[model samples]
Target: MPGTPYFSPRLILGAAAMFGMLLALGIHILGQRFGLDLGDLWGTPNGIIPATAAIAWWLIAAVAFVGGYVTASLLFSAASGHLPRRLQHALIAGGLLLLIAAGQAASGPSPVPTLHGFYNGIVALMLGAAMAFAGAHFALARH
Candidate 1:
């Protein structure tokens, strides 16, 4: 195993990020195609995308699904294939960061909504990462 390459966490993070972004952007595009513009979602005076919004939850779920997949896949591929506590924690942290970064585009286009967008993104990241790590932990526990 000395010369062998391990399952790279960086790759896992990238995969999760890509998956989350594609999902979020796809939803945005879908809304556009349906003639639902930004005005429909955040045209109000507050101009804030609420974390409780369907889009927010959708993005959160996407990150969670992707994060769990990547985490479990790497854990399953490890040489020992044993789930260590520290490894699990580290993977969860990585998943959190990946989800947050992937949601960077979630901060809507306008200045007013940008703040709320970032906040919603953070909320989504936290929930998504937790869901992902929990899923991976439970799944790996059975392995």
Candidate 2:
């Protein structure tokens, strides 16, 4: 294992970031294909369509990546103990879902359209898995 490269936390972060960016792009493409006006999601008053939609999309993606990384870390850490990994992941995923639900309620409505809650939930799950795998690999490398 001398020349073998070790897994780094950065790899997980980078993977999450890339996934987020892809998600953002996919959303945009889907919006255009379905003829859905993303301008509304950007909160444009006159609906004249500013560049804010692009910016907002990217911001959402960034948040998704960070959220995924954190959730994964928490789940892995908790599961590495006596708790089952499935239980730990489920708990963290559920907690994130609840947080998002509360946030949606408090914010009145989601700024981004197109299955906002569901999309984010999926992203969180993906992120959590990525982080868990990365963490596990890194931990193994040390042993």
Candidate 3:
């Protein structure tokens, strides 16, 4: 383990922040232009926003994953070669999700997350992992 290469928290957190900002900006633009409510419109049986919102979220997720993978690759110096490529990417994506969970913990009004909120977070984070997996495939191709 002494020789094992790993990504730093600074690397993961910084990249996630940058990508998260991109997502926030995108959602902001969507909310401003279309006035779609993220909280209200998303879960209903008949959602208010078109499926395009889902597409947009997917695209943003891919971008975030790409950012994460690229950040890790840059910092870890393709020294990651010895590590299983899938494992390395999974670490990066998992780091991002944990960061998101920490963020959610800090932001929500309730001291403790409600059950529904926790459930939704799990679903959202899983979707993120899937997106990151796809992005990992794309990034590996470029590698």
Candidate 4:
């Protein structure tokens, strides 16, 4: 029964950290891709607050992690036999591909700016993949 016990907290924390890193990195990259001054967020009085940003990042990370965990858990439960592993791998790959496509789409000329959207989508995809991987690892390890 050692492996039977689900390490929910560990999985959630690990996934959240991974998601946060990816989100920060993706934000930085999108800012660079399109001419956006990250520092500008500090120009105005309420534009940027280090503490606020950190809190926002943490909130985002936690949400992404929970979402990923739930998705992976559901998928794991629904899949039969070898299907879980295969589905997990496929979902990760598909998510990456969707992220790339979304990024490309966002980069295109549009009436509304999509830089943030593209970055968020990519970060979510990355987080989802991390979650899927964590779930698969736990399931396999326990099995």
Q: Which candidate wins on lDDT?
A: 1
Clashing pairs in 1: none
lDDT of 2 by residue, 1-143 (tens): 35434445555445434443434334433433333433445346876665544544444444444444554454334434545778767865765564555444434544445575456445534543454345434443443
Looking at model 1, residue 127 earns an lDDT score of: 59
How does residue 116 of candidate 4 score in lDDT?
Answer: 52
Give each model's whole-structure lDDT. 0.50, 0.46, 0.49, 0.47
TM-score of each: 0.42, 0.33, 0.42, 0.35
RMSD of 2: 10.6
Model 4 alpha-carbon miss at residue 106, Å: 17
- Residue-level lDDT tens digits of model 4 in 59-129: 44454454445444544444433346676788677656645754674466643247654554455456445
lDDT of 3 at 29: 32
Number of the candidate with higher TM-score, 1 or 2? 1
Cα error, residue 2 of model 3, in Å, equals: 16
Better of 2 and 4 by TM-score: 4
Rank all candidate structures by their TM-score, best first, as comma-separated numbers. Answer: 3, 1, 4, 2
Model 1 residue runs over 4 Å out of place are: 1-52, 78-112
Sliding window of 10 residues with minimal summed lDDT for model 1:
31-40
Scored against the true structure, residue 8 in model 4 reaches a CA lDDT of 58
Tens digits of per-residue lDDT for model 1 on 1-143? 46635655545444444444443443433333333333334445687765435554554466566556654665565534455677778866764664465355334453334555455445544555555655555545555
